[model samples]
Target: MRPPNTPPARAAATATADDTEFRTLLDRLSDKATEDYYNPFTTFDWPATIPTDELWMSPELLSFHGTELMDELSPARLQALSRWESVNFYSLNVHGIRELLIEVTRRVHTPGFELPSEFFHHFIGEENDHMWFFATFCLKYAGKIYPDKSVKLPGAPRDPDIENFLVFARILIFEQVVDHYNVRMAADRRLHPTVRHLNHLHHQDESRHIAFGCRLVHLLWNRLLERDPDDVALRELRDYLGRYLTTSIESFYNPAVYRDAGLPDGFALRRRLLTHPARQAAHAKVLHKTTGFLNRIGVFDARH
Candidate 1:
C-alpha cells in the first residue's frame, strides 16, 4: 500500500493526514489490491475448445434482449448472435483497457499521482493482461476485435482540475458500466465455459479497480468543489458524464455483431435497438448503480 502521503510533494497536498477520507480509503484499497493480487495470464484455463452451440452471453443481457427482435430470432440464430455478441463484448473491453492504459500510464509519473502511483502500477499491469486475454478470445473465435467508429465528443474542459475530475469520473463510469455485465455473466452457468471464466477473471480484478475509483472520484470531486465553487465546472462535468454513460451503454450494440450473426441491415438493427424504449430502460438499469452513486456524491444531477 502507498503511504499516506508519498513523495513528489503535490500528492501530499491532497492525500496527507488532512484528507482522512481519501487517505483512509486509498490505504484500504491498496491493501486489498496487495492481498488479492492475481496473475491474469495463468488464472483461467483457456478452453481446449469453445462450444459453438452454446450461448456466450446470457440471453437476457443481449442488446436486443426483451425486444420483438429477440423473439423473432430462431434459437440457433440467437445462439449465433450470443457468440458474436460475446466477441463484441470482449472487443469493447480490449478497446476500453487500451484507452485506460494510456491515461494511467501518463499520470503514474505525474506530480499528483505519486500516492496513487503504487496502486496504478498494479492497475496498469492487470489491465494489460486483461487486454491480452480479451483480444485473444476475440481473435481466436471472432476472427477480429471490432473497431470503435463512434464519433468522439469534443470541447473537453481546459481547466486542469476539471480535466482531472473528468479523468477519474470517466474511469469510474467505464468500469462500473462493464462491471454490470461482468458480474452477471460471471455467475450465469448457462453460458459457455470460456465466457464464464473470462467474466469471472475480469470481475475479480475490477472489484479492486471499482473500489479505488469510487474513493478517488469522491476525493477529486471534493477538490473540484473547493477549487471551483461557482458550479461552472460541475455543470460541464455532469453533461460529459451523462453523454459518456449513454455512449458506454450503447457500445454494446455493435453493427459488426449483427452482420456477423447473419442478420440483415446491421446498421438498421443497431439504430432500432439503440432507439427502443425497452433498450433505453435496459441501459438505465445497467447504469443504475453507477449513476445513483454519482448523483449521491453530488458529482451528477439529472437536470444538469
Candidate 2:
C-alpha cells in the first residue's frame, strides 16, 4: 500500500521522464477525442415529449435511494422526484462545465502549460458541448435549469502548483462523480431512450476527460510533493479534498429538488437523508472508484 503522504513510486520518478509520459498520454487522448467527436446538436433525435410516467434517472442513483424516505414515497411521487433530480443533475453539469471551462481557458496557451495546451483545446470544446446539451435537456423537459446555489470559497494566497492542483483536482472530482451517474443511467433500461442516449454520449466523452484528468492530477500532485514534503501540507491537502468529496456528494441532495418533487421540509429531508446509514453506504459506493484513485495517488489517506 502506498503511504498517504508520499507520491506513488512511479509518480516520483524523474520530472523529465514524467513530462514525456504525460505528453505521450495527452497525444493519445487527443487523438481519441478527435476520433470520437460528434455534433451534440445533431446527435440526438430530441423527442417532442418525454412521458412523465417513466423514470428520467436510475432509481438507485437517486439521493434518497436506499433510505426510508425513498420507501415512503408513492410510485407517482417517486417518479416525480426522479424527474426533478434528473434535471438537477444536468443543471449541475452545466454549472460545473462552465467553471472548468473558465479555469482551463485561463491556463491554456499560458506559461508553464505550453505542452498540454493542444489537448486543452479539445477539452474546452467538449465541455462547452456538454454544457449546451445539458442545459438544453433541462430547458426542453423541465422548463428551466435549476439555479446554481453552490458557494465559492474565497481564494487564499497559495503556491502556483497548489492552485493548479486544486483547480484540476476539483474538475476531476466533478467529472468522476458525474461519470458514475452517466455510466449507470446510460445502461439502465428503465430510463427513457433519450435519457439513456444523452448519458451514453456524455459517458463516452467523460472517459477520455477522466483519463486526462487523472494523469494531470498525478503530475501536479507529484510536483507539489517534491517542493513541499511537510506533513502539515499533506494533511491539509487530504482534509480539504475529503471535504470536497463530501460537498460533491451533498450537492446531489438539493433542497430545490426535494421541494420541486413536492416533498415537505426540503432542507430537513436533505439533512436526514445525508445522515442515513443506507444513504451513507450508497455515497461510499458512488465515490469508491474516485476515492481509490485519490488514495493511490497519495492525495487522500487510506483512512479517508
Q: Pick the candidate with the highest lDDT.
A: 2
lDDT to native, each model: 0.82, 0.87
> How well is each residue in 34-136 modelled by candidate 1, as lDDT tens digits?
8877777677677766877889899999998989999999989999999999888888889889988998898886766656777898889889999999998
Among the numbered candidates, top TM-score falls to 2
Clashing pairs in 2: none
TM-score of each predicted structure versus truth: 0.91, 0.92
Q: Number of clashes in model 1?
A: 0
Model 2 over residues 253-291: C-alpha lDDT tens digits? 899998989999999998898899999899898899889
RMSD (CA, Å), candidate 2 to true, equals: 5.2
Residue 31 of candidate 2: its Cα lDDT? 93
